[model samples]
Every structure is written in C-alpha cells, then in structure tokens.
Target: MRPKDEGACSGDGMAGRIITVAQQKGGSGKTTLTANLAIALRRKGFTVAVLDTDPQGSLGRWFMERLQGVGEDGGLEFSTSSAWGASYEGEKLKRRFDVVLIDTPPKIESDLRPALRVADLVLVPVASSQVDLWATEGVLDLAAREKRPVMIVLNRTRPNTRLGAEVAAGAAALGVDVARAQLAHRVSYAESLGRGGAVAEGPAGPGRDEITALADEIMAQAGIEGAATIR
Candidate 1:
C-alpha cells in the first residue's frame, strides 16, 4: 500500500484509451471485474487506473482496503467520481495511464450516458443465465446511442454449462462482440477480493488465467500493443 497521493493525479499530458464497464442489472460482478481487470493490466506492465463512478463505491472501498496493505495492488492508480462526473474524471485519468477503466452505476439512465460518451469501448458483463443475457440489451442500446463500441463479457460463468456458449452465440448472432475470455465463477475471486487482492495477484489458479486472457484481448481490441509503449 502507498499513500493516497500515489494514485493517479492530473496533467499526465497524454491521452490513453478509456474503457467503461457497465451493466443495466446488478449482481453482474461489475466491481469485481473492474478491480481484477486493473490488476491483470498492471501485470502486463501497463499504467492502469480506475475511474469508479458507481454510487455503491465498492471499487473505492476495495482500493482503500488495498491501501492498508491487505492485498497486492501493485500500486495501481484509482479514483472515484459522483454519478455524473465520470466523463470529466475519465478524461483527466487517461492522461496519466495506459488505460482508464470506468465502472459505471448499475443502471441505463443519465449517470451511465456520460461515461459511455467518453468510452472507447464499453464492456458489459453478463452472468450465466437467460435473465443475465437479457440484461445486456438495454445497455447495448445505450452504448449504441452514444456511438461507443461495446463488448459483452461473460462473467461468473459455470464452465460445464451451455449458458455461456449460448449467450456468446446469441450476442454474435446479433453482431455484438463477445469476449473470448470467460471469467468463470470461482471461490478464489470472492476470497481474493475479500482479502483486498485480485485473483491475478493471488496464487496461480483458473481465475488468474482467465483475467490474463481478458487483459490481452481487451488491449488488442483497443489496438494497444502493450502498456509499456503507451507514452
């Protein structure tokens, strides 16, 4: 853990890609995805920061917990914002890191729109259920309205089930890009977060492999060669 001042600051003087993680429904593991994804990207040696715009502030809380040296954050930068301040803060954060990931509120309303407007890519996580798959529709429409590219991430996937393959097929049929990497439902994810560390930062496991693939795929989707060359 480091001082609060060690987090991202203003005037970075370069613009990096902005990614917004959003979903219309809750229990999609949105905050969990944000926290772990930051760790995965940092593993790639990129300067990553989070612009946590969710009112629940779970991401902020996790960052605070990590600051107490409870887990392995790798000194990743994190910032928080009110409901509508995501756009402004996201822009500022991009200047300081290779990527700025925005975790939006769990709704498809006003608060989410600004973040979408500034997003280079909007990642929508869908859990393993028809209901979870249905939840992405409104969010997809919202991202379309903002002219932002959207990718569907199958989160908390039960590997043996057909639900994930089905959801990916459905989204593909509709011309939406579904990430090839599926973050499986794992006890390690919950345990690591509780310990203030990402699964990627914990010992080697299925959880770590999934997020490592996710980081690679997301960076490629953003046309990023690597975080080391962002400047």
Candidate 2:
C-alpha cells in the first residue's frame, strides 16, 4: 500500500512555516533552541506555536511554567505529540499560527521522518564539540532523504576558542547550510528556560541578539514574509 499523504505546507500565503529541530544525540540544546526561537518569532509579531514531540516533555514543562509565572503564554501556543503524530498535529497548527516549531526526541531515527516530512525547514543544532558534530550526521542524512531544507545551528558555543572555530569549519564542510548566527554558551539561556521564559524576555544581551539573528535567518530560509516590526 502507498503511504498516506502527509500534508506538507509550502509556507506560502498565510500558512505557518513548520520548523523541526532534530538531532540524533541528546544535550544538543534542541528544546532550548525551539523555545527561544518561538519567542523571537513571537516578538517579531508572528503568532507562534510549539509542538513538542520529545518524550522528555521539556518544552511542555516550560510552557506550563510560563503559564503559572506569567499568567499567559504571551501569544505563544504549546502542544505535545508523539514523534509519529507530528505531521497531523503540525499541519493543524500551521493553519492557525504564523510559525510552528516541532521539538523532536533524541535518537529517533525512522520515527523522525514524519516530522521531517512536515517541516518546511529542519534545524539541526550542533553544539561546539566534535561529538555533537558527529551526532548530527544521522539527522542531516534523514533530512536529505526527505529533501527538506536544513540549516545547522551552532549552539552553546564558546567564543575565541579553537575548538569552536574547528567545529564551524567542519560544519561548513558538511555541504549543508550553516547558520551564521551562533548561540554562545550563556547561563541566561538555561535560567530563563527554567522559568518558562526565554532570553528574549530578559534584558538585551548576547543571548537575545543571537536568537534574534537566527530567527531572522530562519524566517528568510522558510520564505516567510511580512514580519511586523520587532517590539
């Protein structure tokens, strides 16, 4: 039997662009990246929704905390689903929001395909270590198979370090698009996430700037247009 048609949005018109943040290894900061990116986009006046497909439920937990602490999500919507259920839930979300960010679980191989199929752009977060770089291969290959556009995001990077430079070069050598905006290793990223808030909520700093630049790059790559002025 043929595979069921998993609807994929072309990111045209008003359909929300679905961005799946996938990595084969854990601790690559996928959840952190998703949460922060959602906030950045929301600040740009895009209605955002985050679909957490990771079994760990980190994103869901953060959203709950945000609700408790802030009494509102600040225009961000949150949902949870199994990895396989991402396509269905993601498509539904795309209709109602300007951007849908899917956070996938670690080490999910074949199960990652459904999410990839629905993604207009797949963001693979590679930390500043060779181990993290090595772990990204599986995800890169899978996204390639699905013919999804991918951008490698260098997360938790340390500045002025040889290892950081090497990893950036190595990522470029992979022949995939690497994001120019790299997220530095920042304590604020974790502290804000723990509070169900993002760096965007904090005072202007490197963390906020990094996420904003990356979010802008992602919007361009996803072909999303007409972003409102950043508040």
Candidate 3:
C-alpha cells in the first residue's frame, strides 16, 4: 500500500512530511535545491533530515562538508540509501525528523518509484520552457499512480520574464500546484555548495529569501500553519 500524505507542521497530526525531489533530466539543481530547502526548514526551528537516494552522492558529500564547518551548521540529520531501500529508510526518517527530504536520482527507476510511493508531496523543479515542463511528466505520472500531491517549482527563473509565468500557468492548467515563490538564477545558489554549505549558510541574499518563502508556502499547503513543529 502507498503511504498517505503527512502534515506540514506539528499540528497537522502526523509525524512529518516526506518530500521527494525528482526531475528526470539531470542538472535540475535537485541536490542544491534539496540541501538549501532542508537548511531553510531547519532555520524555522524544525527538525529536518535528508534521505540521499541519488547515486551521484552529491547530497551525501554536501552533508559531510557541512560537518567539516564549510557552511552554517544546520544540525540537520541525514542518511544515505539504496534505490531499493528508500521506502524503509523514509519511514524511519519520518519517525525521527519533522520533515524528510528525499533527493532522488535523475531518472525514473525502481529506486525512484518507492520514494514516490512514500512521499506526502513530490516537488518537481522545472525551468522556463516546455522542455522543462515536459521533463516532469514521468514524475507526475508516478505521483499520480501513487495518488500523491505535487508542487512545481520554477528554478533559475529570469526576473520580469513572461516565460516563467506562462510556464506556471500551463502547469496549473494541467492540475499541478505551482509554487508561488521561485528560485532566481543566482551565483549564490551554486557557489554556496562549493563552500560545502547551503545558500542559507551564505550571506543574506535573494537565494536565502526564496528558499525560506518556498518553505513557508509548502508548509501552508501541508496545513501546518500556527505554532506547529515536527519532533
């Protein structure tokens, strides 16, 4: 059986939400987004953990760097997993963290399916084009099969561009919940990880605000408003 959707914060009446970040196309900034989102939520005074299912090991390496004092300390919990082991590890993480962020590989495979099956919400990051939007169909199909909620994030969006808005509208037309906040194409996003930390650990910038705002919107969607917190 598929896992049901969990709460956004403490009051939603569940242990925590399992968010799987997936994009079939590589270099969708999945790892960067995941690390930054995990840190942003941690700053909100919530206990957060990450399940790195990507074989690239980018998330795992980032966490190792974080422990070495390369970035601001998140006190974030982390675990690595095989594609086949994702479901088991995800359940364990839900019991321990307020939120568990799963960074899936760039392809839809047996490993990716289990993670999708267990997610409360699956975040699909797209750029400002139909190509990006098209890339998400496979993931959307998987989420649909599992009857999971989905949120589309427009990453690397150019300011004052009609393309971003158009893409979002097209997505909404197709029944995807597009995020109100978007990530800008900023150097801070990529360079922060070079220092072995998330954008939240860097100097205050739009990158930081965007991620925080996205986190807030996501929690609200999960009905986690008010004094809610995950253990």
Candidate 3, 100-171: lDDT as tens digits: 899999875565788888888889988778788788888888889889899988888877878877877777
Better of 1 and 3 by lDDT: 1
Among all windows of 10 consecutive residues in model 1, the one with the lowest summed lDDT is 1-10
| Model 1 lDDT tens row, 34-101 | 98998887766666788888878888888888887654443377888886888899888776677788
Query: How do the residues 106-127 of candidate 2 rate in per-residue lDDT, one tens digit apiece?
Result: 9568789999999999999999
- Give every collision pair in model 1: none
TM-score of each: 0.89, 0.92, 0.86
In model 1, the Cα lDDT at residue 83 comes to 60
In candidate 3, list every pair of residues with a backbone clash. Answer: 10-229
- Clashing residue pairs in candidate 2 are none
Mark the regions of model 1 whose C-alpha exceeds 4 Å error after superposition.
1-13, 70-75, 227-231
- Give the winner by TM-score: 2
Query: Candidate 2 at residue 133, lDDT?
Result: 95
Question: Whole-model Cα lDDT per candidate?
Answer: 0.80, 0.87, 0.78
Off by over 4 Å in 2: 1-13
